[model samples]
Target: MVWLTMFYLSSMIFLAFFSFFCLLSSFFSILFDVSYFIEWDILGINSNFLVMTLILDWMSLMFMSFVSFIASMVLFYSGGYMSGDVNINRFIYLVLAFVLSMIFLIISPNLVSILLGWDGLGLVSYVLVIYYQNEKSANAGMLTALSNRIGDVAILLAISIFGYYGGWNFYFYTDLIEEDSFKILVTLIILAAMTKSAQIPFSAWLPAAMAAPTPVSALVHSSTLVTAGVYLLIRFSAALEGSAAQTTLLLISSLTMFMAGLGANFEYDLKKIIALSTLSQLGVMMSILSLGYPNLAFFHLLSHALFKALLFMCAGAVIHNMKDYQDIRLMGSLVNQMPLTTFCLNLANLALCGMPFLAGFYSKDLILEIALMSSINMIIFFLYFIATGLTVCYTFRLIYYTLTGDYNLHSLSSVTDESYIMTSPMLSLGVGAIFGGALLSWLIFPTPYMICMSLFMKTLALSVSIMGGVLGYLFNFMVVNYSLNSLYFFNYIIYVGSMWFMPFLSTYPTSKSILVMGSMYTKVSDFGWSEFYGGQGIYKVSMSVSNSLQLVQNNSFKVYMLSFIIWVVMIYICI
Candidate 1:
């Protein structure tokens, strides 16, 4: 009891300090408006400044508020949720580090500063993912780090390209790059952002991240971390505008949105479903921002953080109460056991479904309108609309399996209600889901209705919600295998077998060319993954060649001395 008390107080105090920074940033940004930032001039170019000087703008302020509130609530809630656990101190410390890193990231003014925060965030999050230090969590941490490392390599290549030819005109600076070499660099930057944001083909690891603890998931999925891709896009909007990478961004963003939404529906682990849902939503935000409506992406990101954090925490609470069995099929009628958690979960799901009255509605509507306005292709419009439909379906699935289905307590009826520490964050985040849209009115479209949008978008969004609720409810009572669908086998083959093994195989598979003594053409033709049988040939050739070099190293000194003596004799005779 004494240990628990001491840990909670210390955590609360640490949380208070971090929350203060988030609040202070928002408060100052609002008070100062747009111009009140620390503009840094490094390398003779103006850059962003969050470390030394941070200027809070409308977008940063809003997100900072959401981030801080959730940070505090999560800290407070985790105090109770993890109260008696031995890992409590370790968890709280990482939470503090995570929030601080995000604050620096939010307020940082330049690419260098933001990248520093981005890297720190990646580290602490990996640590947090493996907080349980279990085998599953450790694997999740490695996958997350591996993805981030790919993003890092892309970033380094971009930086090199940017620096070699004048550095000032690239994305971080207010100036745009018109030079050919710099244009190539900027293209690499887009690749980095896509990988970091986990778009389309790169998005597989997010589902794997479900092995993390719930609070870690809430923090990562919601505000600062996963949206790092969209955040980078928005932060560097001036650079991407009318750039060469638009076509690439457009296609990948569209694919990410559609694929991730489908992946969400195909998941049964409540956390994995939410994880995929976030990837899909981030995909939507990336697509919208690619069209240069960053404000809308920022808008959706805000609501997404709040509402998704709520759902994750609520899901966590349910798991906590039920002793950590996370299968949704085992979680029917939790409404009776925990009424507050149920209500909070419903509010979050409503927001996620983008019910016209909730927080997600405004953001989702704005992004679609922007997509239509910016895109010339009707195919893009249709793709986004279909993704919206899937979003609704998955959100409702989460709601039904956790709350209103038949009570299948299965001898687990004695689960207790969540404490104040666990549920308070859900309650706070729930309020945001309820009323955050009007507060974030800066992002709302001034035009009430549009011909291309109103009829199809509203009709589709509403129909999706209704159909999703009905279907998820109808199927809630049935016992079914909720594992991967028909494509799971295929997905495992490509994403698991191919991706995991390709890096290790790419080099030696072609080293067969090293062996063949025939002409280069004949050897090149023979090269493949042939168990390096040809590599053995190369090994023999290498042995012969290396022996030749060794003979030189061993005999070169004596040969050079004899040559010198002969040269001296020749010089004397010539003289």
Candidate 2:
């Protein structure tokens, strides 16, 4: 086990360095407007062909570098967090596989290879989510897997439709494909992206998947699984420009942002709050993508990956020392006890709120500014504003509840930054959270955004951010004796805190009918008809023949001979 851990750490460190070099090379490629596509004619069938295509551009390389870096940090952090587990090697192996799948998805520009990576992510994530071997993990894994299967089916449908183009690769023909002819394919692909990214209607799985180990959550929410959808959209943006599906995505993503932000404020579980925040950030990415700013969206995607990963590591550290207690209401006054972790947490949270100069600020603030300048509907504008505010609101609320209040846990509860393996990753990501935004902003966009909004619109982001902070502090700390015990409040709590019944809608109505039909089939066909025709009927017929044959044999030689003669006569008549 020690050797295994060392091997993983060494492998990740090597990969991280390799990715950094690749990133630098990609930047040069983008500088010269050089993009390369490598294709191999793997198989051909009649008029259709299956090609394995890889695209090397700034976007793919940069995103791949980020994924590799974050994954390396996660693997190092998991060594300490998962050290006590009996199946540590298994966990490490799965995480390695998860990273590989993300790499496959990152480079592929063809539908076939994308699906290969896409399904790999879904399958591996399901396994990771259920790693704990508990009922909750089981339920969460099922919901997660089943929810993502919708997207898988959608992508398969898209591949069938893309066959009309004579190949499954979109990068070569994305600009040439006519909007009218490929509208359905675009819509299906969008649906697949939404499912993978956990947009509205499929948003339930993101939070439920938090049942996995914290490192898995960090990877899934930060860079790999959820981001796959955003990356797909970025690749397919040319086909979707000005399409109805894109317009619909804008509305749905905005609503998703608002809903997730509100739900985070209502949630008490530490991991779920962070999970909801990821959902909201995903909404921000999708909304920007829908508005035809794929570059900005990709920038934010990279920036978010840094801080979110750090945030999860900090949360994992806190959870570790607190004996796995995840309820924020029960945590308090950790600044002195674990000052470094508290610092990391605060920095990551600030970054999440898009504080100026932080990683999130470069991407998030710019996104909001661009949205303000664009000619968008009033609803989307407000959704973007309110959702931005809610981001800060819930973040501040989380800070107050978990970091500054009185010590609320048992006397023996241990809280300290004693583990270097865990704290090292947090520190690494914290640096990125602070500096990554400026670096990526400059790298991705050499030309600054030119905006001409009025003063009021200019301060809209800052104004709402301040308001959200005040509201979060007031609501979580100042408000006391507020109860959800009453009938009305209880219902509202379920509706808001449970994400507007999305979990129920995604799981209950569909699962209930399917389970009922399954039970009916088991009783009627499997047990009843199958038992009779397959087992019981055969046994009864065999018994009857054996009994008659025994009676004929026992009667006597003469009787036996007569019976044989009669049987021969009957056979002759039948023949």
Candidate 3:
């Protein structure tokens, strides 16, 4: 029955056209009632946002437009990309559901409502990531799911805690205004957002996520999923106002930016490099927004969604040409092959580097402006400034290496442009990537500096553009010659080895000590690593505990259940 329904041409038309209609309906809903929320209470169940004021704020509406616009593009692109691939009908259905969830997420009014939309999108992403279900992709999907589920659990706990003290109603966030608990609640929510957004320490999943098909990465990085962090931070803007937590957020964000940019330089996989670069950029935006500038973050997010989407689809085209090979080192000089794909890829990278008159310039420069406001310490400001330099390093590195390398693959020529289903939308996205930043408004912001954004910000954007282009060429040598044995970089063991310098760097040398003479773990540490370390016994004890757990699971379940039943009978008799 499922095959009969989806295999028909008419059914394909209906599914594609139906989702388009849904988008139109959603847009009109935003158009008419977006000023403030008008909601209804559902005492017996969860409150729905549709009952609140129409969710037509500038932010929600803008994101909704992005959802529908890019979604339409992806759907159209998929028709060609998936045409001959096996099990494509299932892919279409999942894509439809994914788009719907994002639209709902955009308009959701309360935390519960937003979570509903958030998890829906996440579930679809998990399905899509493992669509191939090979060993690599399966591991990618599971790790991504586990990391995201950890975030979800934290969110669930925070919501339960808030509901206990605040109210069961989801719309009651406003009810807790000026309360200390509300601030704590927002902080917990921010932690959940950071994990979802792939901020550092939790960031390893994103590179793994590249195992998914390229279009999935396009959608994930571009619109719905990754932006959830910025959305949550912006949505709860006032709650985070005036907290010391902003500085901590800035530090984490800066670290993610630094590490992702650095990691991108070292990775061999074409898509992984871009993925790392994107994670870094998103981290920088989240950090800047947390420091009390949401609009700047919004602009950067908007532009990123445009260019990153283009870059991923174009990369997909390259992979499709090469029969799914991912390493950039093996492929090159396809100016004739996949001309449209190459063009779009370069255009997107240009925008990503924030070249003047491109979409990225408007957004990234705004972030730099916020960083330079002199309210924060000079050291922190310089850190963000340095991050901007790193962004350039990674963005244009892909640009230089991918196009400039001579053909290394055996007997391969550049194919012609992608089919209509692919090329048309790819071209449109490239257009957007080029012009989206050039056309910002003076009236909306209306400041002396704001009016002159082109004159001021564009200049900075051009300089960064030059920096990226120049550095990419200069270090094209380093990118190709990157060695594991030389600087001993990517040797995480070396980084760990260097942590012994902690005592030297620490202001409190005594506090930095890992030794506690009588403590069990320390004694084990001393035994394992050296005469000075003692964690070996602790490791042995942990292994024993793990073996004990294995025995109970294997041999004791029936006995445990029988004992539980006997204890229950004894308790009842006593009662």
Candidate 4:
């Protein structure tokens, strides 16, 4: 136990210090308008050199600071959260490895190095997801691993394409690649990004991945794994500028944002609700990036990382105290018992809803205004606003269920601020959740984005947010006997609640037919047709022939002479 404590403290302190150093470096890089690219030639094939490259720009440095900061807090928090487990050391090691992989990804501009990090993330995340060693964890891990594998394959294909173009440093070749090849490269990169970021068709894993330990979820969902995709696209955003791919990305991301928000509203699991919110925010980042505002996306990514990690940590604390019951229906009036935790939870939730002047407000509000100004189709615009409203709606809904309602857990349950170890991290992140956005905005942008929209357009985001919050709180208000109106629209609720049945769509439907076909093949080839035409048929034929020959032999001289006479007569006729 003493050793574990030392391990946690040392790791946390080292990471915190590193985070600060990176932050300082980011400021210096930004002030000087300079980027450092350090490359070492590892192998050479003619003119094409396989090199290990590291990029230290303001962007990479800033992201590294955020990741390290979050990881530090998460590691510290895990010390308390996993205190009872025997394999806490293993957990700590896995989390550290996860952070290292993310760092590798953040620093590398080369595709080869990025792949090393990318595959590391996928592998480590799968192990973390299945850390609990249960059926749910196993299933979730498989989904997460397999979903990310699609992205890995995309990256590998992209590497091969890059090899054809003579280098793996995509940063240098983004503008130089030919039009047709650029399109293919962009598509592969986008696909890889989509899978990692858990965009549509690839989103089920994000929520399912909540099966991981809360600290792992806090780290993975917030900064390390899911954001890898968005970060990758941000790096490749230059190639995407003014391309048809951006339009497709915009549509897909908008739909993803809308879908996640709507799904969160219907979800009852506390962690799952938060996971869905992460998905929704990911969509927001992706949508903004697709609109040719990679800076805004990066800003949001940094800001969201702070608050989302806080949100997951708060959820972890609640789950930790409530005897592992994650159903929000069983939680209520938490503020009465756990004020500090409840306060942090509310703060994170508000940040998520873009409450004025919070971290989310700085980034989310700008993105919305800029998106409003963009020349997008009505459908995409509608999706953007509706998705934003849904985000607020679900945030308020979660707040009402888990924070404000009547206490629904057993009378004997002891739910309080567990320890300073947990609360300290929450408080630290609470500060970030509140101020991280404004600070990031100042650092990331030299000048503020100029907004020139009509009064109605200016107020539209606020209005929808207000309306969504009111509806969210009011819709869940129940008296002594409230009829379950949701049952009336059961199918619709199930469809939307289940992320348009995405979990089923991603897993079952795609494989169901194939599995059925496989079953048919098994029956036909192995049991029915193969029995007659394959080894079984040959064996049966041989057995019948041998039985006849044995019977003829059993008939002694008479049968043998008769068979010989018949064979001789047939031979004579042939002659």
Q: Which candidate comes out best when scored by lDDT?
A: 4
* Candidate 4 Cα misplacement greater than 4 A, ranges: 478-482, 516-575
**Model 2 ranges off by over 4 Å:** 175-181, 481-488, 525-575
Q: How does each model score on TM-score?
A: 0.78, 0.92, 0.77, 0.90
Query: To one decimal, what is the Cα RMSD in angstroms of model 1 from the true structure?
Result: 7.5
* Model 3 stretches astray by more than 4 angstroms: 1-36, 45-54, 164-178, 412-414, 440-465, 478-575
lDDT of 1 by residue, 40-108 (tens): 444444442122446567667666666767777777777767766776777877887887788777776
Clashing pairs in 2: none
lDDT of all the models against the reference?
A: 0.72, 0.91, 0.70, 0.92
Q: Residue-wise lDDT of candidate 2 within 414-489, one digit each (tens)?
A: 7889899999989989999999999998888988878888899889899999999999988765434255434557
Against the correct fold, how does model 1 do in TM-score? 0.78
Q: Candidate 1: what lDDT?
A: 0.72
At residue 309, give the lDDT of candidate 2.
98
Give the per-residue lDDT of model 4 (tens digit) for 1-575: 78877987899999999999999999999999999999999999987899999999999999999999999999889878998999998998999999999999999999999999999999999999999999999999999999999999999999988898889998888776447987898899999999999999899999999999999999987899999999999999899987888899999999999999999888899999999999999999999999999999999999999999999999999999999999998999998999999999999999999999999999999999999998989998899889889989988888888889878989898888969999999999999998898888888887977899999999999999999999889888754124776578889889999999889988896478877889899998888888788888899999999999888768688888988999999999999
Local accuracy of candidate 3 as per-residue lDDT tens digits, 1-575: 46634453454455446545644554555456445565665443343222322365666766666666676677667767777877777876787688778777777766666777778877987898899879988877876786788678767877676665544334456556567766677677778888789885567677778877677788888987888877877776666667766667878887777667666666668888888778878887888787887766776887788898998888888777777788887777766576778889888887877776788877776777756653777666656666677677766667666776667667745455747777877897898798766543231233534433345544554565567567866776663355645555446643432222221232133234532334556456544465433355666778899987887677677868987999999999999
